[model samples]
Target: GKDGSPLLCGSIPGLVPKQLRFCRNYIEIMPSVAEGVKLGIQECQHQFRGRRWNCTTIDDSLAIFGPVLDKATRESAFVHAIASAGVAFAVTRSCAEGTSTICGCDSHHKGPPGEGWKWGGCSEDADFGVLVSREFADARENRPDARSAMNKHNNEAGRTTILDHMHLKCKCHGLSGSCEVKTCWWAQPDFRAIGDFLKDKYDSASEMVVEKHRESRGWVETLRAKYSLFKPPTERDLVYYENSPNFCEPNPETGSFGTRDRTCNVTSHGIDGCDLLCCGRGHNTRTEKRKEKCHCIFHWCCYVSCQECIRIYDVHTCK
Candidate 1:
């Protein structure tokens, strides 16, 4: 039980000193924090699987992403956002499930009820989740630099993604499922929904400039959009300060592994296509034979039979 105890927060990987302190204070929520990080990383990989970067992680270091997040690129912004959102989402879910003593379902609905529906059921305590996530995740960032400011903004954007997607769920109560009265409660959208929304924001991420302000407490760094033609990014949008490297070839400087053996679509004109993914270096095509079950027949005696078939397809990879 000692190894499995939540109080062993110091054993958790990828946690900074401040985060370790936070974990010890909120021991019960440590599992959810770990779950949130896993969720965020998984979603990052899923969202960028076909792209050049592909959200690769290094197993050698507790930093997890190696030097990939050291730069304030759009890729880093997306990672920060998704990771922060994962923590909030997981904590909120745990609260709704009554797994913690400090928090529970949200009972802070304001205003009058809707026409026919009244508030009922458990609304997830998203505020508590977001607050805890901020306290824990932002603790690691103690620097007063442009990259830190960018990361903080992107992190909030990710958590805001969860809040923005919250919807009202209602249950009908009446005779034979008739709509005599309805009870509605706020519910969180699926994590995939948050990932998809953030992916869109990543595509349209705003480029920003560092503004240094002289105050009583030394110079403070802030971010402002480089382009002012459109509306500035709100709390729900991602922001980046630097341009990303072309990850077609292995670059130790940028922490890019490249796409040497990565599969590419021969016909697609998008980022996943051979042309873009290979960085105009051309691709190698190979014929692969795959075995599958074919010509299946259902027998009248509750048995089914199928014939084995060999299928050949052309596979393309970056040169």
Candidate 2:
């Protein structure tokens, strides 16, 4: 089956040789990788919708991932975690479906402690998904550097978050509508839920040090000593080695394209507000008329109709 199922990511451009090899090894995981990447991009866009970067993606290749990931910034940390989590969620959910030959009910988890429901209603094998995802994602950072360590840890955190959110779902069925039978299974949390969780982690991501130490015993990280005000970083936390730029003006050095020509919410007072989004550059307004369907009415036959309406609105853009 692995032979027949070619990895969807095998065709992806810009992947290094080792990454290609990893995908080939888990061919069935390929589809999950593809789906996961798309979801990751979407989640990034959602999370950064009002920001300068705006989490844009290009279709030609993975270059769209850009130099952002190359740096150990908060943005990169979020990208890694969200991407890994997306893959884990996709693969885990795939396991429970009839079409998935690669995985099925988490044999590891004993079903619901003496369940009254169907013994096993095709639960998602979340552990397997997390493991494979970690292997592939963490492999790239095998180098002996503090950045690599942080990346690996964040990757694991992503998988951990996905696995943590796997919930037990149940369904009820019975003859004559009696409440006698029930079916339960493990279900993957919605990708949005994972995105929201990661967003929270991103907001409070830790900044760490890449210190050099005597290797008498072994090579170990020493972040606690540097950032003593906070507790040691946990598997649940997102970690970064560097600070991010304000991203106000186009700076190729930091991969920021600036906010020029970008839309702004003139009336808001948050980050999306014109003052902030324009970066003290101010904004220009233009009025336009748009048409939309309105005054819809539902019919007895489950069909509805609507009439066209026109409205005018002001548009604001960064100078």
Candidate 3:
């Protein structure tokens, strides 16, 4: 049995001829019928772990086992990508059913499934890595209508526009109440900061403080009256403000304003900043109640004087 045959030579790895290394590597990497059958058997074992399964027919066993093997292979590819790239990823147990409301999947029968895991990259530019599955590829190709609907939704929801990248998760739970097909996408945090920055641009600094209160009923109403025509400040506006001499000295702080003894008194300046009225003084004098009771006096005279000053002399003009 120890004859100098090719099979015997190949079986002994170190003894194999250098010329045959390529062939050996190819054989090692290539898929085979035996491997496929073994994979099918393993999948069946995973699916019915503790059950005594009696296959009624050969066709039934093959039908039941085929998809499991296919799924395993797909998952292996995803795992390989994760390992190679040193990226963290996760698989959802099921597809997002209610996402139609947020992601707009209702208008169409089926949509691009969200699944897979995301990894944080070192740089802002290196944000995400994705491993697409064969099923996802096929869905995109075969289902034109569904794909189109998803594309439309992605555009509308700003997912494609806002998100950096997307990848399919190589896992599936049974498609029942909601399709268990999983998928996921990556987004940059800076993109979400736009809304907050825009809000701050339109609102006054006082409005920002009042918004933190428990009950500030008239703040929005007051702001709307004056700043209805105000647009969000752009980069140009910020640059101009930075370069302007009046930007910093408009309201120089004499001392810390919100301490227990001497609180910086806030007054209401009407929509045009033309009518300033000191509605109250001290931290506790606002329409909204403070956490601790304050001893500061709420002077009506100061409120009236401030209002008169703003209207008559433009005392609180923005620098």
For residues 252-275, could you state the per-residue lDDT of candidate 2 as single tens digits?
A: 667687899889999898889999
Residue 298 shift from truth in candidate 1, angstroms: 6.3
Clashes of each: 0, 0, 11
Task: Give the alpha carbon lDDT tens digit for every residue of 74-141 in model 1.
Answer: 99999999999999999999999999887899999856779998999999989899998899989977
Give the residue spans of candidate 1 off by over 4 A: 1-7, 293-308
Model 3 per-residue lDDT tens digits across residues 1-319 = 2233446336633322432443343332112212322332343333322121211113544333222212212122221221212211110100122211112111221244334322221122111111111112112222223223222221122221212233222333355735343333222333223223322321221110011122344212111111335554222111011111111111222111111222221353442221211112213332332244334555766632222111122123221
lDDT of each: 0.90, 0.79, 0.24
Top model number, TM-score: 1
Model 2 error, position 167 (Å)? 1.0
User: Which prediction has more favorable TM-score, 2 or 3?
Assistant: 2
Runs in model 3 lying further than 4 Å from the true structure: 1-184, 187-195, 203-319
**Candidate no. 1 TM-score:** 0.90
Q: Against the hidden reference, what TM-scores do the models get?
A: 0.90, 0.89, 0.15
Better lDDT candidate (1, 3): 1
RMSD after CA superposition, every candidate: 2.6, 2.8, 32.0
